[model samples]
Target: MRRRKRRFLFSTVCTLFILLAGLAGAALFFRIQGKIGASRKTPDALFLEYVECLSKADYTDMYRMLDEQSHLNISEEDFITRHKNIYEGIEASGITAQIGQVAEKDGEAVVSYNMSLGSIAGEINFSNQVKFRKEKKKGYQMVWDDSVIFPELGRSDKVRVSTDKAKRGSVFDRNGLLLAGKGTASSVGLVPGKMSEDSAGDLETLGNLLGISADAIGKKLSAKWVKEDSFVPLKTIKKVDELNLNSMEPREDNVKNKEFQDELLAVPGVLITDTEVRYYPLGESGAHLVGYVQNVTAEDLEKHSGEDYLSDSVIGRSGMEALFEKELKGTNGRTITITDSYGTVKKTLAAKPRVDGKDITLTIDSTLQDEIYQTFKEDKSCTVAMNPYTGEVLALVSTPSYDDNDFILGMSEEKWASLNDDERKPMFNRFRQRFAPGSSFKPITGAIGLSTGAIDPNEDFGGEGLSWRKDESWGNYYVTTLHDYSPVILENAFIYSDNIYFAKAALKIGYDDFMSGLDKLGFNQEIPFDISVTKSQYSNTERIETEVQLADSGYGQGQMLVNPIHLASLYTMFANQGNVMKPYLQYKEEPKSEVWLPGACSSEIADRIQTALGKVISSEHGTGHAAYRNDIEFAGKTGTAEIKASKDDRTGTELGWFAVFTTDPNLETPILLVSMTEDVKDRGGSGYVVRKDKAILNSYISGGR
Candidate 1:
């Protein structure tokens, strides 16, 4: 028993001692590991820290990681500034790195590194060596130099960047007529050295010819880089081609500019030279359709951060230019070169090939577009001309417009102010806008009435004078018409433009049927066109809350607003067997027709309305009789939209509208023209617009676009 107890005690003591030894070993190992972790980085690690700092553009930290010798050679400010100037100038971002082999010799080392940087020239990649020197006190530190920033860069070398501008694509009409394209303009400049001894008089003459003030010319000449012999461009004037109507260039404007150019040549120190320019050949005739491009502002660059745009880049501002900007603006090329103090290229760092913009061909007929613009340029008007069968838009014109070329050539402050300040709202794009469609909307209402089976074409709504209301429940407001015609059938109402007949038809259709009818006709829907316009709506709200509002909506009053393009599309149903054609701007081969609303009305109903439309133009007593032509059979409707604060208030302006098309689709070029003019209240109302469009129709039918 004594031997067993003594053995057990010895075994327990041995186990305890062994356990304590194992714990001591673990503690010692942990202490050694902590020391390793807390110690200064290895030579390769220090270089990696420098590179990681470089990736983040942390120049201050990177400078701190340099050795004493490097610090003595360059100040922290200089180091940071150099890195920032080169990196930011090239728009560098998205840096990635890969560390290669590190070979050490004695106390110094060279760590191989491969880095990638995203820049305007695309991805820049290079493999280089980073030097590390073992310091007396700081351990391993980087040896900093300009070469660390870029392998091709030396201490005194500068990085020179050059941009190759891509050729902007031309815009053409369906017949290959140039709309917006490349052209040359006269660049009027002044050379200080060539000035007369009486330089004051010479400056005055030069300023007058260039349409600039003497002080403005003086300011330009006083620029920091302007030398005595330097030719400082003052302005660019439009050049005209007599044979080119496609450019929509106004002959008078060009002639005036030519006279100025000639007079400028007579002035001492003045130089007139040709320079390439982006031109809207259509000028004021199609200004609202083609749009213009201008130099990029700081705001544009900030908004499009990662885009390819540079400080001096040009961007589309409005119209077709803005609509197709992405495809129309080609990629610009760039080259980054290392240059010496004298600006001689030492090495090429990176380069990119230029990509030219794609050309655009529109379905528009420039001849027709110009003609329509000329007719309405004196007034606030909007017009849309299209081919009813093919759904191809031929012309979109908004008048009281500014020359688009003025934007590219630099418009005067006075001209710009006049446009904005004009109560006519010339800057307001009418074709791209919505308006109270007036009586032109009647055809649509009539078709909707027939489609819903709420209207009988032959049934008489009887005589109700010139104005009417749904019932006594509707107070004050009444549906009004211009003419009171007897036996008011659908066709007869169309001929006389009787609003009461259509109003009664709408009341029978009721609210639910009317709203549903509007939905089928593409109300509250985005029209599938390249350029966006506000959707057509019967009312601002979804539901019709009153009988009077519904009655007014039937005659294209109340809140019945529509886009000219959409209104033109609605008319296509009359010519296309009850199908609303989808209007397209971009030209396609074969000119295929696309149905936007299939069976908006029945074929028989479309024919009945179409026949009534023809009679509206042909009948002697018709409101649209002013546009009757002996050469071509025409079909059309006239509308006068009353803009009133109330039914009793007669001081509001009126919108004159005329929607017309040819009955002969077999003609070489079938056209549907819809025009609307503002402030036509006392100016013959819809007749004013009808007369203006008559000339266009006559010119079109006579092959005189």
Candidate 2:
């Protein structure tokens, strides 16, 4: 009984001691937790103090609060300079600071605050997160992990503002095939604050994967490094396609710092960003028509202050883009979000959606344009074809054109120089360039004579082979004869392209009547068309001292200027039965609507002109007989314009021209083709030899043959 009592008492005493010790330990633990909680709490007065310090330019205190990496990266002088540069007016006005809630987790604490600068107030809501750890003898110290700045005040009273992401628009061909659209391109960027001793090795490995030199990557890094923050992107690699990006593998060797490594693993600076670039699968073809976009300049910014609502990086330089910029350029969308100093996205503030541009259907036939371009590959020339009735441009071809893709992607200075240095002046639109009309003007003279009744169609005119006479006033001017002095009819004059015949006819017609014909055909007037227009000039001088000068004028030469488009439209009178249609390019949805009407001419005169032109092409002596083809019955004319060889000599270059109209008996549609060539000496009659090759015309006639 005594042994049992002793054992029980000892057990009870041991149990009591254990219970009391546990209770004391619990109280001590609770006390330590309370002290930690109190230390983590941020005082509202601290925010006001910070604002006062900043206003007084207290650099030491500001530097003390910054993270160690930020302190090491930026000097005191630089910190002040950056602050002054970015926020110049912040100091002069009284500021206010408002403290927000404080949050703590693990050994870290976060304090948020709002700051307003003067009357021009804005919000600065920063997330001041710090890590605390014990140091050797010093009890404990705090280290900042990250900081954030944000706009606290709204821009407008509209509280329902929702932010939107700007999705790039798409580009398509006439067939709706993708040309230029949004896609991901591989790039390289850096976070300077995160870079450490191991960063070089990491960068070297990344460079190898990217197929770039380490030095190149380093140079880029050095240029774009952010001193105060690690989240700002530093560099961007251009033109990296998807396949290459997909092959890239992230490894520890490619990202040194643990935090940066995690970031690289998730969202690598050598990341693929969704971007838009101009593309052309047809390569250099249709380059001139499509044109290109380039970086906007200061001058451009000023000129488009209010009008520009899209990208600041691009603008239409030429071609259709320049001609119809307003219709083609769409409004851009924007997104405003509250972000922490580390660029971590907070809540989205506001957004506006982009408006898409309207699609434009061009009148150009791609196949025909390509054919015409190929024809002039070995030669230098321009060709233009149009529907006379509607003035719908079918083809406009200029050889030696540069690819528009190069311009869009950013052309180098050397490439630009090479293109501009070509002697052929490929950049110049020959279709719009001026050239002497030569003998092509003869038909206009004929129209004038007929219109004024100055010369009857059956009147007999004498012709000479080469009429040249010395005149003191005009120098040794010379006139060539039409078909030898025979009683040739009006049709015969055009068939033989009789120079003397027209000269005599012009004399009877009088200058007033000739000028009237010029005005009637849109000469000396601005005509609206898709392709650029170069005004045609007619010489007003009546009499020539030398017979040769008169002969030249009679055959359509000596100071007469006409473009292919102008000359082509002149033949519309014949095709439309004497009603010359005013040429236009804008197509109307409803054909009967007079919104874009092309005025018509008298039908009686058109019939006469048609009859004369038909005889000129089909007749034995016709100059344009070579242009005849079996595919379609056509009326046409050929002209060889004589230009002076030099400033001092009578001999000059010859310009060959051909204007033809395919007449569909059904009258459903009439196609007109005008081709012009300059200085084809070996090829006679203005080098119409190449023009008559019929490749372009055959394609047009046979539907892409």
Using lDDT as the measure, which candidate wins? 1
Taking the tens digit of each residue's C-alpha lDDT, what string does model 2 give over 572-670? 666665555555544444432111212233566566656666666666667777666655677766777767754366556677777777766454445
Candidate 1 local lDDT, 87-112, one digit each (tens): 88877888777889988899888888
Residue 32 error, candidate 1, Å: 9.4
- Residue 645 lDDT in candidate 2: 55
Query: Runs in model 2 with CA error above 4 Å?
Result: 1-218, 221-276, 280-285, 309-312, 335-351, 466-475, 481-486, 530-532, 540-554, 586-601, 645-651, 665-669, 687-693, 703-705
- TM-score for every candidate vs. truth? 0.88, 0.62
Assess each prediction's global lDDT (C-alpha) against the native.
Answer: 0.87, 0.58
* Candidate 2: Cα lDDT at 234: 31
- The Cα error of candidate 1 at residue 47, in Å, is 3.0
Error of 1 at 551 (Å): 1.1
Write down the worst ten-residue block by lDDT for model 1: 239-248
